[model samples]
Target: MTSTLTRLPRPYQSYVYAYPHKTAYRPLAPRPTLHEVWAGEPRDPLSLYLHIPFCEIRCGFCNLFTRVGAPGDLTTRYLDALTRQAETVRACLGTEHSPRFANAAFGGGTPTFLEAGELIRLCDIAERVMGADLDAIGFSVETSPATATTDRLAVLAGRGATRISLGVQSFDENESRAAVRPQRRADVETALARIRDTAVDVLNIDLIYGIDGQTPASWRYSLDAALAWQPEEIYLYPLYVRPLTGLSRRDRAAADLAWDEQRLRLYREGRDHLLTQGYEQQSMRMFRRIDAPAPGPDDYSCQTDGMIGLGCGARSYTRNLHYSFDYAVSAQEVRAIIDSYTATTDFDRAVVGRAIDADEARRRHLLQSILQADGLPVADYRARFGTEPHTDFPVELARLAERGWLADTGPARLRLSPEGLAYSDAIGPEFFSTAVRAAMAEYELR
Candidate 1:
């Protein structure tokens, strides 16, 4: 277990988008069948995700499992494999489970990286093959400026995509070069215009801070540029230069106190600017326009429910186990993983995954809820877990209070203080179980 934090950890620790982090996952012994995995899981509704591991360009700071290009029959073969995986997954979920898909998302290197016709085929696999109703669900897609073509957006809009998230890391050309995300301001604007022509209910723009050569003035320039379009949502990500990424080969993003304080300053700047622009801060990375359209019925609550992911890089989560294919960051290793996935015929069992136990569940609930701006409802936590959060992890909670990271909102809630949310990256890892931390450390050494 990590020692009590009497002092502050680096502000830019690891991002906690998922619990147990995928790094903790290992090759399951005697792998559990999908049918068994879903046997007693909730059947009310689930989130659907289809991952495309192809991108036009690889960003320097990205460690996501994706390749730069899909040439010749690569896309076709990948889609065919996805179709097979979806059928197998649906058959395993079966009528006995009575699964209902409430919402869906197409994520990836770039889902829009496919051609216009390919996008249509991808939609067919989701609806016709997987039994999901895109037309009636809160469907979202991730895209990039180079691939957000008119025809592609038209197909997505026609297929009932409710939201589109475009990754425009930086509008400043120099900053982009520094991050190794090549693009021009003109291209980003053009893509935004094409998306506006569509009927998608929400549009999200992603920007990055802490890039080399990025100044407070330059960061504000990028923020003001994104604000001009009145996007429904904006995400300001702190740049991370992890091993196996392009930037890691360089000397940028030194993980010292200087880098941490610099990023903290930039985050405050971006957060304050968004609040003044009438945007509501949802989390450390997400800010939504105050008037942004509300989500539709059957929205997926990932914190509690299950998710079905049908891609090499995508991970599926049951209440206890989270599983997926092998993860790789380098181009060669990623290509090898994708090749294995495309050639695979048996998609019935979970080969690689981590099993979440009872104790971790409480920690996950608290960490996920506390990281958000709204905080966690203590009553709900007690009702569900049948115990108080403070009872489960007294040392962790007390340390937070001691650091002035935990807020006092009376006994009804367990929420992070404003200062706590600012250091969410540090706080999230404090909850990582000893088992998970060891596994992650072992993976890094390998």
Candidate 2:
């Protein structure tokens, strides 16, 4: 049986992180209040995410929910809206059921795009408005080399930011140009120096593989350059050209079998190289230094815990629903959503999301947990759902086993083999319910 399963074809899907794309989200009529959404849910340690959807420039291959540049007063208005939303959400959570946030992150087009003063105010919203202690919990922020200046880093560091993730897509100028991410190596080095000068405990540098004209040698060059910083974490991403992105118009040939083979090879090379450098693989994209301080609370688990997302681009998740403001890729639509988000006075519960039934919840639990280096624990699954994973996903489990992807199918646990982990992208989408696929397909691409 292990020899007979059909292997997926080339351009193998890479589900690097989270699943069920926001594209699948639909409008929720008569949106429920946040109080109603959290009524019976456990007030466990929650994760907080704030989205800053403005960037100095948009990369070609980028499809994230962010716009390029902020027009006059747009940043200020957006921040005001964020504060209002936070206050509203805080009120919704109420005093008694308010959750204790164990982890927090500021991500987006670029959180550092704001001025130093704006960054300080951003921290105030999290601390004073949302009631999160930045100094007590792990606080991470995403930045671009161009925006990560000394003053900005100092502000973040002063506010108790433990980790600073810089997007240094590549060290080679030509590759950066090829990815439509213009940046000089000098800028990255300068940013790294500034970040270090702030004494931030953890520095994460992000790199990309499989860019056009990026050869094995060039990949190694970028890898070696990133390792030179001895970053607490390094993320190697395989570039994907999505619709409406700047790179989408370039060429479709870049997504073929040969390209995938090159990407796979580069991924393996980076992984093996980092392992040799004494880094541990956290996921297909993340590698953590052995001695670095843990990035998040040990007790917080995204699989089961609730998340509070603040911003037009952020998505909040409860036990059964994941909701956010409208998602868009095009410049016009993003601007419109941001304008609406800023002008609105109502910050209620979910207004756009798909309801997660029991089966979907089980699938979400499995997909989120199993993709990690440590496979899912069967006992925990059974305890949570009162049934075995095999009982709910027998066919999928059998197919994985038939493909030699199951490492162990013990009574106590169901672990994926390393080879299985490599194919995580292919496995994750297989669990998407038929309803989700239909909804996503029907959703208009904004």
For all candidates in order, the CA lDDT equals: 0.89, 0.86
> How much is 255 displaced in model 1, in angstroms?
3.7
Residue-by-residue lDDT tens digits, candidate 2, 343-443: 98888767887677798889888988878877788888888999988889999989889988788657777777766766777787788888877887887
TM-score of 2: 0.96
> Which residue ranges in model 1 land beyond 4 Å of their true spot?
1-7, 252-254, 444-446
What are the TM-scores, per candidate, against the unseen true structure? 0.97, 0.96
For model 2, the superposed segments whose C-alpha errors exceed 4 Å read 1-7, 14-16
lDDT of 1 by residue, 1-446 (tens): 54223257788889999898988899999899999998889977888899999999999999888999997899999998999999999888878666788998999989999999999999999999888889988698999999999999999999999999999989999999999988999999999999999968999999999898899999999999999989999998998889889899986545466777778899999999999999998999999999999866745666788899999999998889999989888898999998998898889999899888898888888888889988888887887889998898899889999989877898888888877888999989999999989999889521
